[model samples]
Target: MAQTHTVTIPHFVTEASVELTHLTAAYAMYGTPHIQPDGRSNILLVEHALTGDHQVDQWWGPEIVGPEGVFRTDQYCVLSINTLGGCMGTTGPGSIAPDGQAYGSRFPALTIRDLVHFEAAVLDELGIREVAAVIGGSMGGAKALEWTLLYPQRVRAALVLAVSARASAWQIGIQKAQMTAITRDPHYLNGDYYHTEHTPQQGLAAARKIAHLTYRGELEMDERFGTDAQTGENPLGPTLADSGRFAVESYLDHQASKLVERFDAGSYMILTEALNRHDIGRGRGGLNKALASSTVPTFICGVDTDILYPYHQQEHLARNLGNLIGMAKITSPCGHDAFLTETRQLVQIMHRFITRIST
Candidate 1:
């Protein structure tokens, strides 16, 4: 298990200058810290996706970061910080407010840049002035990209997978629908449902179902379930209430329920809102100009079947970034979630990228 640590920032001002007092950052580190001759730790920062926490090994584990993993603990110091507005041990809607209640509905808005700023502060507290590499996928990828731009001198390299420089209209539209589902739930209680007996579990489940569809490939979905009905349920029953469900519906339901049991609905809303606002070029001029200005070594990867963030986004980044080695296409049937599902392929790509930079 990774050891958890917290750093208290007396005053954390957001990019918009929103004052956030008494901010706390929760993070975990793997492997022993190895200080380089240049006074910086030989560290590799791993940013997690939407529902991920500092527990990188739990989801990524031996497949990505253990002794047998691509980023072996024995080789380099590995660390992961729970992003700002995260539910798991990080400051978010579930965290306590100055008024002695959960922030809940009152939690301030956040952006991808704000998350990178928070991570920078955490790194400062740990005396980590620079990192060997920064890596992430999806929402995590947005942060990794931001880090390369925000602190170019501090980051030696960055690996971003399954994300874009900015969230597209299609992405925002889907997120808006998910947000609407959460707010429309009767139990949402205007986002201040912490003290209530019921949370917006049903609403969150609906949102997850919608997201799950986008996370998976259409061909894979059809191959797995096709037109088959769930064994115990009948789709064409006499009564509508007694109608059976399709195999696909059952799979989505399981995914939804699993999230509801482990995640906070309010945090989900905040993070999704943050994701919708992800724009690496914001306030830094235009996308091409912004990427072209950065000299940090960057490795871009995209899922060939990803519908949410298509491979073209990575292609664009590779074309523009001043210090890029081109984009690596991860071929998998898992769609947008291929970064997490296709571990072996991801490892190979990352290994090659790291080797090229090191040599």
Candidate 2:
């Protein structure tokens, strides 16, 4: 019989002997060591979706990281660190500040670059100077882009999926509307409402509803729930008390409630607002100029059905990446969520790319 033991992993702050100025920052790991007999490791860093946790393979499903999966844990070490401003184990508004209370709305404004910095700190602590590849989709993809830009030497290649170089004006507009809903909520309590009276569950739910629509395509929505009526009573309206709600509305409600259970309102505001501030060009010059600085080879992928980041964005990034070696756009009806849905296609492409590059 095999013996079982419990072990505590070392924190990055302790390992590096450095102080993390942020109120919170946590990370998780997966797979066996990627070290060769010579002692060098091939590492894959996966960035997660907006509400995603560090359990990448688990959340996205085992198809992406199992023994026979594209990532092939037996061959390479995989790391998926929750973003800095996330409500996960990582530091964020929900974390208690130095003042011994939650940072709340006072959490420092963080950008994708800032999240990359946190990841770099983790890598440095782990003595990993170079990663075999960085992979991400949607918000995760944004972080992947920043990683290549900020640490060109450390990231050998980046796989950007269903994401743009910068958040578009339309993206900003939608995010702003979501923020407005949260702020306008009487239960928000100006963000310090933690342990006070009420939480902004309703407002956050509304935001999730809007975001879920963007995550899927119009065709998908049409196919899933065209004009079917929900059987539940209308809670928002006494007038609709007799009439049935649309199936689409029911689906959105399900997404919203799911988010409400695991997500924090203040953190949502902070992260989404930070996403709005996402731009590699901010201080480095412009988008094209910033990307030109990266010496890393890039693998840019898009979903043919993605409306949020759209396929053109990936094409533009590939054109500007200079050292891009692979470009693919998987066809799926799932839109932005296709990356999570179509693992088989991504697996084949990634396996070839990783093997070719490692050789």
TM-score of each: 0.97, 0.90
Model 1 earns a TM-score of 0.97
lDDT of 1 by residue, 285-339 (tens): 8899999998998999999999999999989888999899657999988899998
lDDT of each: 0.88, 0.78
Where does candidate 1 stray beyond 4 Å? none
Which pairs in model 2 have colliding backbones? 24-91
Candidate achieving the largest lDDT: 1
Give candidate 2 regions above 4 Å deviation.
1-23, 35-40, 232-242
Expressed as tens digits, the lDDT of each residue in 235-324 for candidate 2 is 345575556578788889899999999999888987787788888787778988887777888888999988788899888898888678
Poorest lDDT segment (10 consecutive residues) of candidate 2: 1-10
Q: What is the alpha-carbon lDDT for the whole of candidate 1?
A: 0.88
